[model samples]
Target: MPADDSPTGLSQPLYLCVADELGQLIAQGQLAAGERLPSVRELSQRRGLSPTTALAALRALEQRGWVEARPQSGYYVRPKLRRLAEPATSRPPSAARPVTVGSIAARLLAASNEPGIIGFGAAIPEADWYPVATLQRLASQAARRHRLLIGEYSPFFGLPALRHQIARRYAELGIAVDDDEVVITNGCMEAINLALRTVAAPGAVIAVESPTYYGLLQLIEAQGMQALEIPTHARDGLSVEALATALTGPQGAQIRACVVTPAFCNPIGALMPEAAREALVALCRQHRIALIEDDVYGELDFAGQRPLPARYWDRSGNVLLCGSFSKSLAPGARIGWLLAGRHRDAVRMRKFTTSAGTALVYQHALSAYLETQAYPRHLVRLRRLCATNVARYIEAIERYFPAGTRVTRPSGGFVVWVELPRGTDTLALYERALFRRINFAPGPLFSASGRYRNCLRLNAGRQWTPDVDGALQALGRLVEAG
Candidate 1:
């Protein structure tokens, strides 16, 4: 039997104590691979540690690839931890996998129903705040005229009217694109996927911002592409110097593309400065690399002037601009488009094979909605609401979280990044919060290498309801108790 010594009296921190115990259990073969471990709550209760401490321990184990977490259910030893393969030069044949919407729905629904839980987790706008009535009117009008078109297949690129609207919108951003340059996809996610597929083969090396949107990391992993994380700043987006170093250095030449979110990036709402943006475009040009710009949150900026995307500086047509109405409008609409620039024809063909085309009816509806003067007015109001809510969230976080808790002051976007005091495990906090009828996204999810264990991103888009305050207090209590 393993030593039964109490976790107390260890010279290390309490979280370390918990982690050491788990490590010992695994070493003793008492916790074998695929074996279910105690739930975060059960472990906390058994060890007399706060739930936060228990979660930190588990997250540490998770980072080491020793465990896996299933939604709703407790933690279990991973069946196998797959190591990221080294970068390769060739493409692999496509393999078909079952698309499971159920898993995604379960996670979203579970997160939605948590009592006393402030939903700072999803990137979605609050349900009541979006312009639902306007969309309804637009949809009705579109159906009145395009009833026949709804039953037919949309062109592989997209509905012509929608593409024209997209191109016109890009003109305002200083990106000179015509209707043919735009390719509609299910959402910005698919736009990005198609862009990556068009430019690079599987197992190819691609550069991505550190602490990028978790969805992007998942996409890279799914495509069997290896990502080299370029160090980025909280205030200025991706560091051009770091990127230049990566590009000119040994790893730079092999990188097929660089993916960035230039404006109001997810997790970190950094907007690249104009000079930095120029430099980035120049760097990509110098290195002959493709720059895939994810600008999903560009329209949500509430601070200074909304900076144009890096695509504006793409004189060489190396930049692919991917954007969507998912964040600005309702996510269910799933209307997203891409300006593939030089890769237009390649992307068009990929779009033909992959989902055929985005829903034509939604595209027409959104196009009509965009033509109205109300769209920009609605966006202005939405930005103000997000800014106000984010300010309140910062105040609440300051009041409740312990000293030394570092929170990001994002100029725009609905998410906030909180850096907890070192050694705090957010995943542990997540598990504990679940029991308290709260849910949050843990930090490690945003990293490709499973780093950032002490960091957590909160969705500040929702209103500061009483339940939200209570949840913040609860989270604070968990941190302090640890």
Candidate 2:
């Protein structure tokens, strides 16, 4: 295969041109596993090609499993590859719930069907823009090793090497955890669920942000627990003062656990300061509350440094730290892990009973890939690309949205929260955008209390282009119409 620098003067197809450029980078070890490639526009600008040509190159790479696409976030390098293998058991089918058309979820799902709709609703990363060739090499090596460990199930916790990697990774953030403390799971959602199950019983009261991650609310509701809403701020997240007061006040007495996204929280993209994190940990310690810290977005920082989870302040083993590769790596891999301080035994028992364990092949592959140091190297590049994309999205929002529209500037993470004018219902705007084939997450889905009716969360992980800009403009029109 001739590189783009060939002097033969034979013109390569545009897609081939883009792919050759990527291939050279991978061959030179510049694009490592888990790294994101330049956005389509960025690549197009560099290669002197159009956006469609660049996308075609990326899509071709995607088909080969060289990269994986996150829902709203841009593409990311796949961790490692295993042969096409079916899950031992299909995901237990969710029973059909009565479909209520006008309900918030139904409306949101309905809006998803419209073409050319800008999605500000879902909190997924763009998956199409990742570097795939690097992942292919990682996967090839992993698959080759999988044959040797075909019958082995990782130790009840997880692969020791991966555990050690997790510990070392956390240590860089000022969290000191031993390898034995971590238990791998399917995703942060599972990690959080297992932690909650370990500490709180059905009907227990779990305090959560008033406008918390809707998934957590569902989990609480699923466990037959009541979520006590504590007021949270868009800038600080999960107010420590409010939480301290809530605990000592009447509501605190009944709370069994407190689940929070302390760093780069979802929906609002707020990063709790170190002092507040310490204070919250102290309060949880005093109140004897099991603090489940969701730090899925912690690794995607755009600011000075990544923030440590509240777990860093815990000396009493009260904090259960949940993290996942789904956000930072490949989401479809369904891999996540938790460091359940004092609650390790309960989490382990739940893991064994819930699904036995995560896919053995994937665990082995991911472990092998991590050993290559590809993940961290990939992350540095990915973060830089994400930061650039975020700035681009911010510029678009400023240009298109109404003058008084307030937007949250996230230090890291793929979500950007836009607070629209009061009384301008996002649900109504969602309907209007849907008619125009635009999809966005309405703000109400993030709230347990049905607040933030005028807010919307935009995915800033994709390559910003003329079409993306146009989509934002269309959304602005809908917002103004409302």
Model 2 worst lDDT window (10 residues): 85-94
TM-score of 2: 0.76
Once superposed on the true structure, which residue ranges of model 2 sit more than 4 Å away at CA? Answer: 1-118, 128-131, 148-154
lDDT of each: 0.75, 0.71
lDDT (tens digit, per residue) of candidate 1 on 1-482: 11111223223467765664575466335678889889889998998879998999898767645678888887888653222121111121122121222333346457766665566677776765567756766677877887677677778888888889889988987778988888888999999999999988887778877677878877877788877777767767788887887777776657889899988887877788889999999998888889999989988987535678888888888899999999887677898988888888888889888998777777887888778776776677667667756655665676678766777767888887777887889877877777787666777676666656787788887755557778888887887776
> For candidate 2, lDDT tens digit of each residue in 1-482?
11111232223355854554464344334677789987888878987889999888877567545567777666666654321111111111111111111357656765655566666566666664333444445566766866755576656677777788788888887778988888988888899989999999987878877566777877876787777777777667777776777678665667898899987888767788889999999989988999999999888886537787888889999999999987776676777999999888888899898867776555655666666766765566556556656655664566577755877666678787787877889877777777676677777776555667777878787555557768888888778767
Candidate number with greatest lDDT: 1
* RMSD list, candidates in order: 18.0, 12.8
The segments of candidate 1 whose C-alpha lies over 4 angstroms from its true place after superposition are 1-117
